[model samples]
Target: MPKPVLIVGAGLSGAVIGRELAEAGHVVHIIDRRSHIAGNCHTARDEASGVMVHVYGPHIFHTNDDEVWRYVNRHMTFMPYVNRVKTTSAGQVYSLPVNLHTINQFFDRTFRPDEARDFIQSQSDPSIGEPVTFEDQALKFVGRELYEAFFEGYTRKQWGCSPADLPASILKRLPVRFSYDDNYFSHLYQGMPEHGYTEMVARILSHDNISIELERNFVRSDAGDFSHVFYSGPLDGYFDYELGRLGYRTLDFEEFQYDGDYQGCAVMNYADADVRYTRVTEHKHFSPWESHERSVCYREYSRACGPDDEPYYPIRLSGEQALLAQYVARARFEQGVTFVGRLGTYRYLDMDVTIREALDTARSCIRAFADGLPLPAFNIEP
Candidate 1:
């Protein structure tokens, strides 16, 4: 009998890789430190409200990759979901992404798309030829008024730092739409799993050759047991933080239940410096397909990740990036192990991207085995 491949972390990365390898005639053993699967994307039903709550905030799967979209759909049904984000700033509500309608409403004028575009251009900082920081990017893209109202406070609270301290790439993710499209993502396929993310992941790992163990903490020494070990845990944790811990921002969700609708929306950003929490997410609105009289919500608070805290977002500042490069060098020298997933790579990856990379990683592993070569430490660059 051939030795089984060991997979540490039963999230989408581990699950997808395990499924693919199993289908290709490899016994795969998956394990996660968390009792449940899906990692941060874990979703479950609230017994009190009967609403499917995103245990660690909401995760709406949106992607342009047809292969990844079709792959997930094969396991479970996906309900169409368009994320229309709303923000409250200075006692006024507004649409997110700073659309044309938002511009007109903010200034109380009927400006056409062209007029709005020209007005924004006039308002932008002409002195800033190149944006080097998050603050510079916002001022250059949307001007001061819109940036202050929509991004400044929210960003400061979310990242626990001044917008100026962050890299310009952080604000580049947000788009300034010319039209009144409130949809958060431009992906062709966007939806939430019909049952839940956990169920979808569970179904994916239901192969005869794949065995999953929950609450199983994996260590570096465990690599001796399997033919090859695919680790999806934090890269720093894998090396016991010998090069010092990589900086990460963790979240604190203050969950509360209310009768009827709480905010009448899935997510509402509190874009005021006085507002302690970054945003409040109403779980019921996440799955509009289901109706519920009571709603569950979470007021999200962001802070520096402690040793015991679950890391949510990687803060890839200059210092952290330098430290990561050292770890990457160390990882390359490590044998019989490959680091995979968001935490392993120390980057913020969406659900679709995670699945796509996992699929590609699995294919690379298979090819390496067939060619009588060792698998590389990372299929996707960190």
Candidate 2:
């Protein structure tokens, strides 16, 4: 180790990796281009509303993994949060996830669970045995009307592509409940950090040896030090795009203020394809424990990431995967720098996966150092 390891980006992934390495008796330096830590998960009180608001968007922590649930619980006090989502489609407001209530209400029927299932099955076509596109998957699983009402337009709006063009696997988790459960996710544990995500991340970097430098930009040429480097920044940037750049989607949030309450729900998705925006997130509902007379809301718009936008979701198109493979090949030939995290690996990962991966990366680094083995370029494949 020549110098302390340099970890670029102070987001959840970078913070986790740095904390793990520092705890394992390795020096780490974290540098992020943003002025604040915690990346997009940053939350703070809106001075006017006096409510904890998610600056980027509403990021509810929900995961089924036991270890991941325990890992986050250790740092921050998590208050139970069930993301009850609704959608306004064709001038009708209904529960999301194609639940029994949504289906019964949307179709103006009072059918019981068994009757609802029979009715939906009757509407579904028996001809298509295998589904390929998002449209096919939704129709095959939840019937044509519910698919059009809930997913078809919404998927197109969110992904900026036709539902027919999207992969069927994307719609595999289309929640169709036999009961009337409106909570968006079926994860066992769901909550938001009591103090907020930023506080949790800052606590993670509270070690003496792990230093952080915000508002600083790092260049690829200077990645030479500390026996190895842990690169959590964008992988395409790391390799300087030896292949062409990957496709990504970034969200644009429009802020609005209101008195008393806003939508009365956390997220109100506009599922109709005609609607330009995806969903409007009311920040007040995110922190149910906190009472605020005024409220903060964000109208979220999804667009294809340009050269200048902050990439949120990796498109991971077939061509981009091939390009990523090329970058992976080039990265393997390089000396020290391990790619770990969402942007680094170019995969859409929630907080739990990032935390687990960072912990694993640190352990891998320790093993490589002890055995005198060459450091890995990437701990996880994109």
Candidate 3:
């Protein structure tokens, strides 16, 4: 019998890689420090409300990659879901993405798409030739009024930093539309797994040749037992933070249950500086197809990640990036192991990106094995 390939962290990265390798006739052992199969995307039923709650937070799978979309559908049924985000700012509710509807609603005027576009252009700061910071990007794109009402306070609260401190790339993810399309993402496919993320991940790891061990804290010593190690855990954690811990923002969710609908939406952003929490997400609205009498909601608070806290978002500022480069250099020299996934790469990755990269990494590993070459430290560079 061949030595089993060891995959640390049973999240999408490890699970997908393990499934691919196992299908190709390699025995794979996948493990997670957490007892659950799915990582942050873990979803389960709330006994009190009988609603499927996103235990960590809401994860709506949206992607433009047809192959990746098909890959997930093969594992489980995906129910149609479009994230129509709503925001409350200064005692007024508005459609998110700063759409034409939002503009007209905010100004209390009816304007056509072209008229709205012209009006926003007038509002935009012509002085900003090129946006370098998040603040600059917002001011150049949507101008002061819209930026202050929609992005400024929300961003400050979410990242726990001034908008000027963040890169322009952060604001680029959001689009200011001239149309009434309130859909949060412009992806080709958008949905949630019908049975829940946990079930979907479980099915992904259900191959006979793939064995999963939960609550197992994988260490460097365990690498000798396997042919190769695929680590999806935090890159810094893998090295015991020898180069110092990478900065990250962890979320504090205050969960509460309410009768019937709480906010009448899946997500509601509190776009006000006075608002302590960034957003409130109602779990039942995540699966609108399902009927529930009660709803479960979470008021999300963001803060600097501590040692024991579960890191949510990587704060890849200049300092953190410099530290990450050092870790990446160290990882390149490490033998018999390959770092994979969001934490491994120390980047914010969506579910689709994670799956796509995992698939690519698995293929590379298989090719490297066939060619009698050592597996690369990272398939996708951080």
Q: What is the TM-score of each candidate against the true structure?
A: 0.99, 0.96, 0.99
Q: Give the TM-score (vs. native) of candidate 3.
A: 0.99
Candidate 3 Cα lDDT to native: 0.94
Candidate 3, residues 244-264: lDDT per residue as tens digits? 999999999999999889999
Task: Report the C-alpha lDDT of model 1 over 1-382, residue by residue, as the tens digit.
Answer: 8789999999899999999999999999998999899888899999998999999888999999999999999999999999999999999999886898899999898998899999999989889987899999999978999999989999999898999999999877769887999898889999989999999999999999999899999988888889999999999999999889999999999999998988889999999989999999999999999999999999999999999999999999999999999999999999999999999999999999999999999998999998889999999999
Off by over 4 Å in 1: none
lDDT over C-alpha atoms for residue 46 of model 2: 88
**Clashing pairs in model 3?**
none
Going through the candidates in the order shown, the clash numbers are: 0, 0, 0
Rank by lDDT, highest first.
Answer: 3, 1, 2
Superposition TM-score, candidate 2 onto the true structure: 0.96
lDDT per model vs. reference: 0.93, 0.85, 0.94
lDDT over C-alpha atoms for residue 133 of model 2: 82
Cα error of candidate 3 at position 103, Å = 0.2
Q: How many backbone clashes does candidate 3 have?
A: 0
